[model samples]
Target: MSIELPQRPFFLAPLDRENSGVDFLGLRQANLDMMGEMIPSINNVTSYIRPFSLLSWIYWKFHDLCTEAGIEEATSDDLRLFRERIEVLFTWGASLHETAERIPGISATPPPDQDGVKPLTFDAWGRVQSSTSLIAALWYGPASKTVTGLGFLSPVPGRGGFFRVSRAGAALAQALDNKLREDGERYNRLLGTLDPVEANESDAIALWSLWSPETVEHEEMASFSSALTSEEAIGSNDTLLSRRSTTFALARHHLQEVGAEQSIPKIRRGMCFSVRPDGSNYDVPTTLEECRRKWLTLQMRQLQRLALETLLSWCEDQILRYDVVDTSAMAERFKKSWALTEYGLGEARNLAELIFKLDTKSNSVEDFIRSVNTNDLPDPFSIMAEITEKFRQRDPGFAVPCFFGLLQCASFAGAENAPPNMVQLGSAPRLSLRVLRHRLVGLGDVTVAEAFEYILEAMVISQHFSTAVNRFDGRNQRLRLAIEETGLTALVSSAWVPTVTEDRLAMLLTLSAQSDLVSKNFDGEFFSNGGIKNESI
Candidate 1:
């Protein structure tokens, strides 16, 4: 069995560009014919297997080659090698396609398993992983002309094709510029309204306003209309009320730490005297009077809470239905569902809910605020603080929650975190796997079977701890008993086994046990009953 690659047009009317609009149907047909002609040459016994399976083998082979060569940089030579490999693979792929078409049942062949090798299943969704790896490789590898050649067939012009290559280059330049612009815009927006006069005076007032619920309430209805009108009439050009609002907002930010050094005598005395004891006079005030003025100025220049609140309300209204939280009238409906409390997960769920809600109706800012309790939910600053604290703690459980919250919030604001891998999984598991694999392959520190034993032992221990306090039903007694009886601690402490291997095994077993328990408790037909099939996974 063999397969052929799909043909593409060599030249087509510039799809969405200027000055080139000629139909290239003949070129496309010709390309396809060329691909067909090349297919048979690459066909072999392996053509009977699935195209994806063959692709996996090719990819793994490349990985092994790269490892052997220690080729982290995509130099010209590396690129040449890659191109050759890709060309060969493409030819092979085309043959497989042709064979599959010729032999109807070719895809049904059981994929081969190499000696002592685990049968590798090609994930249909592996495209995402591949894309991720591609990005990583490009980022980490040295610069190369190979990228240019690689992009020759890319849909985006300038990126690959001669005509479009400049466009791609320009696009990259534009992207960099856009990023700069965005960062500039954000910086300006955050500090945009800052007036030296206001910043020096009103900062304290703003801080007080944000932290004090009483002040917030008072300001909420404190005649913003009057304030705006009065500020406008002052011919100040800069609105005092708007500035004040900004100050308050900044004060509320988790990153901003105010009044932390107020108690130091020297600092306090200097603040009060406007002069140091050594007689160095300062331009700024030293008394409460001066402090009040500075605080007032800051408050005046700061962003208004009402405006921000309104903006948030508007965003909420726009995306409430997609909220992942409990939306049904019956609490029982979500009794079995995961109840995430960490800010990130909650925020993610909330944002999802908001999105769903927006689809149902044209939500207004007022409606959004009225519908939800803002006080109960942590503010953005608080959420950031939570994430930071969790990260500092280096607790995976805590980190996951924070990561989820940050991801959701950033998404809601139409921003994405740097890279998925940064938050994909913890470093511990990845590092552990790498270390163990290196020891096994490079050092021959342990037999393959011994390695497996160590890994399983670690997994069992982790499983015990994770299930010890199961949140699902608060009933993980059996799991706890199993761990205690299994001598998990003793297994973990075994001299010959690596800690990581033990941890890995424990985590796996815990997951398995949890799944089993969920299955036993839930209706047999339910997806959570442990027989659930996931297409994506």
Candidate 2:
């Protein structure tokens, strides 16, 4: 008999395992180093502002200055905030030191010999430095903002539609396109190796497993016509089909109750055949079992579609925030650890292609929904769900991406994953370090409570939160300059990497529930234990 060795515990897994090391400490340091370069002053503003926000801030500042100088025309049109305007603003801001200030009070003032001054006051080299710093910040920042920064917004009040791309932003978008093309070619090659029907069935089977534990049977899943035709049940639960909740527990609870899912299928089947209250069917039922199956299948399809769209939205946003070609240790570490799964990589490409194909300058959920054709076909969402579940199980690399999606969604609270608003109720990113204290301990390379505390404290210190003002005044040159030369980079580059434990996923639901950034929430255990409160806000 062959001897076998027991699998090592996840926490004790060798730190140098091919793909299991967590270099969050190193990433944290690099992020800190990057933050040092972002601020105009140390005491005045936090370096927590991300790249697109930095770009937007620059764009708006440049616009204000140029308008003051009578060089650029000002319109209330939101669409005017694109790259052309950005470029004009950048050029003007870069060279502002060469001309007198338009505002009377600051007219004759010299460029402050400070580190954190506004880019407009900086010399040519300083302007370039500031731009480069923003670019680096983009490279280090969260991925969700990238998509929104480059995408066209649909028209809303006080704004028409606008689609703007800087040369760099356009290049980043193209890089994503090329990456997607490569992924598509790879998936296609994989497809060629499998039997078409078997492959389709396999994909379907995989996705269906994640959607529900129950097998499809010949019975009707729900009462379609009975619920609708009855006067007493019109607004009751019987009329509505299985409304899938995001949580596995709630969904399981619903299943145990034998309520929504059992009734909704009948309503769907009734509608499909145009069954009327007159006891006359406009169309005959082919088979009750088949109709039931179809109804159940349709519901799964809709739920899965919604979930996939939500995930894809988050994915694209992350991709746009971080470029495919980013080679920094931080970017690569995140990609290898969490962001890039085999399926997720493929999905990212699909999202890129889908986004690139958009001809409309302004796009919305309705537009996205209209673009997909769902008539008389198998549910695509089921396949996606299967893919997501498959990779999440087999791919150790997928853990972080799963966590990230959860975090992103928590930040948005079902809104489209656009740029995050820190002050928003659901801003998970802003609140992640603050809210997820007790749970964050014993996760990944974080062995001791002190490790978690150190990381959390670092994240808070690195951010630029303000209770008094909503934004920085763009006037802290000395502080910004000082942080740039802080010399923390050398120490971070040499930090140790650690193995991750499985406990991180244990609190996934709790973390998801705490996505609201503005809430004065605390982990119950952390609170009861008298742990220091999250003072980030």
Candidate 3:
């Protein structure tokens, strides 16, 4: 049976401009609906989860696994990708036009002979006219265009729609101004109260207070309006520009340079694409792409951390609601039957213990949300920060179920995969199967059979190293022995082609072996275990 969660209105944290009561959650729902209509891959409700934390953890974990396996080649490839990304950032900064020229298909200029004709395009991005409409299209996504055409928010007189929207935008700007002023006051107060040692620790907060509002110049607003409305606007780049938060930063810096003195216009209503206005200053390297890469990367990290924080908060709240206060007390609580509970206390305890190190002393959920600083955590992709130390441990226990649920949501796995055997089996085997299923399902867009082969390939590569063993357990015996005695490496290597049914069955059997539910000989194959039913496979 599928895990059917109670239906509730989907919630999306508001963007800076959307803070002016712009119906952020409504817009996100509409966007999701529109995207589902446009792209088959994103049609499922589960697709909305966007589990960046889990995905990043898996990738970094895989990297660690590769290093442990002594697959130097795979590790070296990671280094290559890292170096290339840095180089790409440098290139993006130096000259966007030049970089576009070097990348054959990437073009800053329109196609030959089509430059003069006005182009209107529609696709997964919805309908857009040109750069002129970019601000509107991106702010509300498809909602702006559709809502406008329906005359709900038309620019036509007496509609009051644009007026309301414009007012909303104005409200957003006012809110930011108010916040900056407040932050400035707070910074001064802290500076005055704190000693030198304490002051040094407050640098990040102080920088935030000082730098955020300063990034905006009161004069640059008119130039920004001009850039949005200019006759030279093209729609193709508008989609790219709309999705990019750094574009706003670039525009602000430009207006500042040109000395445009108009107040920054209230962000138009429906424009919810702006990143949280932390007021980071950008010296703006020579190229737009560099600025974009830096900003996007930073926002991604921030977003992932925010999502994780949200999850942790929810988990903590669940634990508190259960009134299980002490860590040691959880074990006793677990002994009681959890038949009526929506989730076992065992599960809640596991999640709490895992993230216990990261928990703060906030009295309420709101307080935690307001005060928790994501920057205090390690870098976004760091396993210790995102997945925490619990996952790195051999058995994460009670945390397994919730994480598996998250993994299912992230992968857009159909309901058919649910009510897994783990539900009936005891917790230990359940955890192993859940982890195995996670690895199996998380493999790149390939069929289960192909995924099986991919794992086999990793195992084959791993077998070459005599020291390699399953990281799941401290002992390095089974996999190593299977590799050496049964010529498992040679067998798997010979079957390097696309996956066949038998090969998939073999891999499933191997997973069963890993779970200790099946007996295995020196060869990496499973033998009959009377305890496991055929349907369990």
Candidate 4:
């Protein structure tokens, strides 16, 4: 007999797994060592800002402010302050709003037509950073800005058309598309999905099922209709013809219910209900069944609006301001246990990557949508060869700008009998580190929290960073010089990779570690080579 294991909570599995590990050249090794003497509780502590919890915060936030009250009814100033939040939500939907929120100051929406500081200043590289990202251009920059960042999107701005229900009626239109009714003069005024006159509800449903497009032309139903309409013998001799005519009688009754003035038409069509009124027909609005179904239609409309921007805008803007994207461990862990999206955002991202590599820049937004529906992606490896040949004269530096995607693809490495051409990333590069410390020039020891905060603040500033206004105008020069010496390379890929080379990653890892806010305790035993191999924690 096989053993069965109980399913684990989605949140707990990752929380426990990432708590400790044998990291070779990564920050974990060095961080473990430094915190060993400072505090024993670091690795053992719980965190509010772990990867899974943080990604799902938006969902919980919606439940708190939007879904309960309903999206159409939402008055969240965060949703109302800037229209970009609505646009981003529609593009990325509920799943990707977490990433949007993390781009510092994105939630700081000033009310429409009012002054607000621009979110996202440039990064160390000066462009292609979070502040200057393609999303930011469309979300915050001027209406005329052109974006080439990933290449799949066009700037579509304007708010409040997202609601889908029409004033004419949703159920009638939906039923029409299903081929349940005829497009005669009666048109949308006669609904075909509902029960027909002179037939019990179940009988109307049976008549509808028997008359569908798939079975409408079936030999059996066609023969039945032929026998009923035939000139010779169906009158008193054919019992089947008599039953078939009885079955189609309800359709004829329904034409009368809609007040058709002509003589009863042949009972060739299926069951239908009339929205149009005639003196012979009873009032539909007063009928209990008709009134209930319309009320149900209203209920569905409310449910649909819950996920739209109108309801989402009612939240307290404060919940959208949670900004621990890169300073925390979130940057390193999102890939393993990601929240999935319904916006086709992944396929959109894939198509964006494919479009960026195309020789001609003439593709349209329609092309992207068509490719998404068909999933007809051009082979990237073949595209790489074609692009390289085209750029041979230019030598456009893929080595720096897109080295991440250009690196060896190993998407199939874990398969038991992996294809010979596919392989995982090779061994970690070797690096060295030393214990790090800093002090104020005239004062005493600088705290770890202050150090991490300084780097984060530096990233936010367009010019020099400062504790107060003019405290460290020179810090930008020092940080810029360090990044320049480390020689930050560029990378854009379907999956996340360190934008910098391994050497540069180590350089920042060492620098960033000395500033870690949570690096207060370490279990150094995990750092030993034998301890990593032989011991399990």
Measured against the true structure, the TM-scores of the candidates, in listed sequence, are 0.17, 0.19, 0.19, 0.15
Order by TM-score, highest first: 3, 2, 1, 4
After aligning candidate 4 to the native by TM-score, how far in Å is the CA of 122 from where it should be? 15
lDDT of 2 by residue, 8-68 (tens): 7322222232222232212222222221211101111111212222343334343444565
Provide the lDDT at 79 for model 4.
Answer: 33
lDDT of 2: 0.26
- How does candidate 3 fare on TM-score? 0.19
Worst 10 residues of 4 by lDDT: 525-534
Better of 3 and 4 by TM-score: 3
lDDT of 4 by residue, 145-170 (tens): 12311111123244331112221112
Off by over 4 Å in 2: 1-330, 333-366, 374-388, 391-393, 396-537
Tens digits of per-residue lDDT for model 3, 67-149: 67566544334432332222222222222322111211122222222333212112211323232121123222132122321
Instruction: Name the better of 1 and 2 by lDDT.
Output: 2
Highest-lDDT candidate: 3
Report lDDT (Cα) of residue 405, candidate 2. Answer: 31
Q: Which ranges in model 1 have alpha carbons more than 4 Å from their true place?
A: 1-376, 407-537
Whole-model Cα lDDT of every candidate shown, in order: 0.24, 0.26, 0.27, 0.22
Error of 1 at 282 (Å): 38
Rank all candidate structures by their lDDT, best first, as comma-separated numbers. 3, 2, 1, 4
